[model samples]
Target chain A: MPSDLPHSHGRRQFLKLGSSGLAVALIPVSAFAETDDMLAAQAELFGDRPVQTGRVSVDLPPIAENGFSVPINIQVDSPMTEDDYVSQIVILSPRNPLPVLAQYHLTPRNGLAAVSARIRLGGTQSIRVIAEMNDGTLWSGEKETLVTLAACVVL
Target chain B: MTTIRLSVPDTAERDEIIQIRAMIQHDMESGFRVGARGEFLPRDIITRFECFYNGDQVFAADFHPGVAANPFLEFHVRATDSGSFEFVWTDQHGEVWTDTASIQVS
Candidate 1:
C-alpha cells in the first residue's frame, strides 16, 4: 500500500504538470486560431491568389494617438485607364473584431484609386490594403500602427 | 438614425480630381460593451457605404464594428461631367441613410 501511495502521488503530480503545460500551449493556439480565421477570410475573397506586395500604398500614422479615429489613406499606383485601372480595394484589420474593414469598388471613371477615411483600431495591429487591378493582378500594402488609447475594448 | 453631411466642390475643371468628404453623426456602438445595468449592448453600426457619380458607383466601403463613431470618409473622383454625387450609408438595422451633392464641371 505504501508503494501504491507513492505511485498515485507521482501520477497526480504528472497530471498537474501536464494540465499546466496544456494551458500554456492553449494560449498561443487560440491566438493562432484567430490568425487562421483571418487567412480563411482572405482566401475566401482572393481565392488563394498570390498577393504581390507592391503597387499599393497605405498611409497612416506610425503611432496613433487614439484607435477610435485613426486616419488612413490608401493609394494604388495605376494608370486609371479602361484597361489598366484598379477594380477593387479591400482594407483589413486582422486583430479587430472583424478582419475585413472596408471594400472599395472602383472603375476607370474614378480616375484615381485613392481613398482616405477614419477607422477604429482595437489595439496595436497592422492595417492591410489589397488592390485588384483590371488585369486581374492583386497587389497589397500593410502598415503597422501603435495605438496609444486602445479602442474596441470589450469590458 | 443619424444626420449625414456631404461636401463636394460646386465646380471643377473637367477631368480634375475632385475631393469628396462625407461625415455622419453616429455612435457606432460595437455591441460588445456592457450597459450601465451590466447588460450586453446590442451592436448597432453602419455596415456599408457607397458613392455614386452620375448614377455610377465611383467609390464604396464596407464598414465594421471597428470603425469609429461619427464616421468620416474622404475620397477623390474624376470630375468628368457636371452631375450629382449620391452617398449612401446602410446600418445594421437595414436602415439606409442617403445624401447627394451636385458638381458643375466647366
Candidate 2:
C-alpha cells in the first residue's frame, strides 16, 4: 500500500474534524460565561432609544471628601403641567457597581420636576441624569467629580 | 435607629417656593469593603423615598446603592394648603422610616 494518498487524505480528514471540534467546544463555554451582568439591564433601558443630551443638569461638588454622603441634585426643564410634563427622572453612575442610583417619578400634581439626594461613589466618575417625558422622550445630563474617600473599598 | 427630622414652614406662601428639609440617620454603607473583616460588604440600598402633602404623595424616588448613607434631601415645593407634610424612606431590605411636620399657609 502506498502511504502517500492515505496520509494526504487522512490529514485532510483530521484537519476538518479538528477545526469543527474546536468550534463546537467554544460555543457552550462562551454561552454560559458573562463578563457583565449589569450591562444587560442598563442597555435594556437605554439601548433602543438614543438618549438625547440637554434640558437636564446634575450637580455635585467638584471634590468630595466623603463618598458616603455626597449631595446630588437633578433639575430638569419642564412646565410640570397636566398636559405635558416630565414623567420620571433617573440617576445613573457609570462606575458604580449598580449604576442606576436613584429615580423620581413625577406627575402634574407634584408641580416639581426636580429631585435632591445623597449618593455613594466608589471612585471618581461621571454621574448621569435621564429625564423621561410623558411623551416618551429622554433627556440626559452629566457631572464629573473627584472622590477623595472612595465608597466600596472594603479595607 | 435614629430620629429623623422633617420640616415644612408654618407660613409657607402658595405658588411661592417654600423650603422643605429632611434629615435621617443611617449607616449608608458603600458596599466596597468592611473594616474589620477585610472583605467586601454586600450592597445594601434604599429603594424608595416619598414625600406626602396632606397624606397624598407629592414627591417620590426609587433609590439605588449609589445613594450615600444618612441621606438628606432638601428642595422647594409650592404650598397649596395648610396640612401636615410627611417624609418617608424605604430601604431595599423592606425597612421603612418616616417623619412628619405641619405646614400652614399664610
Candidate 3:
C-alpha cells in the first residue's frame, strides 16, 4: 500500500482531516483495476520456456450458474513412469484477484495425472492450466467459463 | 478446531492405482467481502495441503484464496504396499488439520 493511500493514515492523521476526510477513509480500497495475473504467473514459474499448447486440458461447464464453486477437471497426457511424469501443475485464472489458484505437485506414485476440484471464479475468464514434466518440459491448456453470479468482488 | 474428511480405498492390489479424496471444513474467506460497517474482510484460508504415503510425501498442493470454501481434493495414488496415508492441511494463520487412513494391499 502506498503512503498516499487514505487507509495508511494514522488515527491522529485521520482526525486532522476532519469529517470530509473521514468519509473517504471509510471507503475501502478495492481492486477495480484489471490485472493480467495469468501472464505474471507464467513469468514467475516457467520464465522464458515456450509454453506448448497441448498435452493438457481442463473440463468445465460452459455456463457457470454460480461462480462460488465451479467444478474443474484437469488432465495431463503423461505416462506417469519414473523417467517421464508430470512433476507439477499450476492453475491460473486471468481475471481472478489472485492469478495463481493452486499448484499441485505430483509424483510417479500417483499412477495417473488427473485432478478434480471445485474452484472459485470471480467472473468470466479463461482458466489456464500448465503442466511441468520431470524433464522440464512445459505443456499448457486453457478454457473459458461464463459466470452468471460473480465471486470475489465487493463494491 | 477443524474437521477433516478423508476417502482412501480400504484395500487395493499391489501396484494398482487408487483414488483419494479429502475435504476440510472451512469458511475460506477471500477477503473481498465488505462488512456491514463497509470494511473489507481479511482473507483467511488454507494455504497448503499435503498427502504422505507411509511417511513419504506423495502429493501436495499450494492453495490460494481463489479456491472455493471448504476446499475438496480428488487425486490418485499408486498402491505400492500396505501402509498409512496421512493428509494434512495448513491455513494462512498456521493452524493445521490432519487425518490418517490405512490401506491394505494384497
RMSD of each: 4.9, 7.4, 11.9
Positional deviation of B91 in candidate 1, in angstroms?
1.5
DockQ of each: 0.59, 0.54, 0.53
Please say which candidate is ahead in TM-score: 2 or 3: 3
Interface RMS deviation of candidate 3: 1.4
Q: Which segments of model 2 are wrong by more than 4 Å?
A: A1-41
- Between prediction 1 and prediction 3, the one with superior DockQ is 1
Give lDDT tens digits, candidate 3, residues A1-155.
56776665776576777877777668543422334457867888889898899999899999998898999999999999999999999998878877888899999999999998889898887799999999999999999999988886542
Write down the TM-score of every candidate. 0.85, 0.77, 0.85
- What TM-score does model 2 achieve against the real structure? 0.77
Return the top candidate by TM-score. 3
True contacts kept of each: 0.80, 0.76, 0.91
DockQ of 3: 0.53
lDDT of each: 0.85, 0.76, 0.89
Ranking by TM-score: 3, 1, 2
When sorted by lDDT, best at the front, the candidate numbers are: 3, 1, 2
Tens digits of per-residue lDDT for model 1, B1-106 = 5678988999999999888889999988877678999998889898889998999887887877767788888778889999899999999889898999998899
Q: Pick the candidate with the highest lDDT.
A: 3
| TM-score for candidate 3 | 0.85
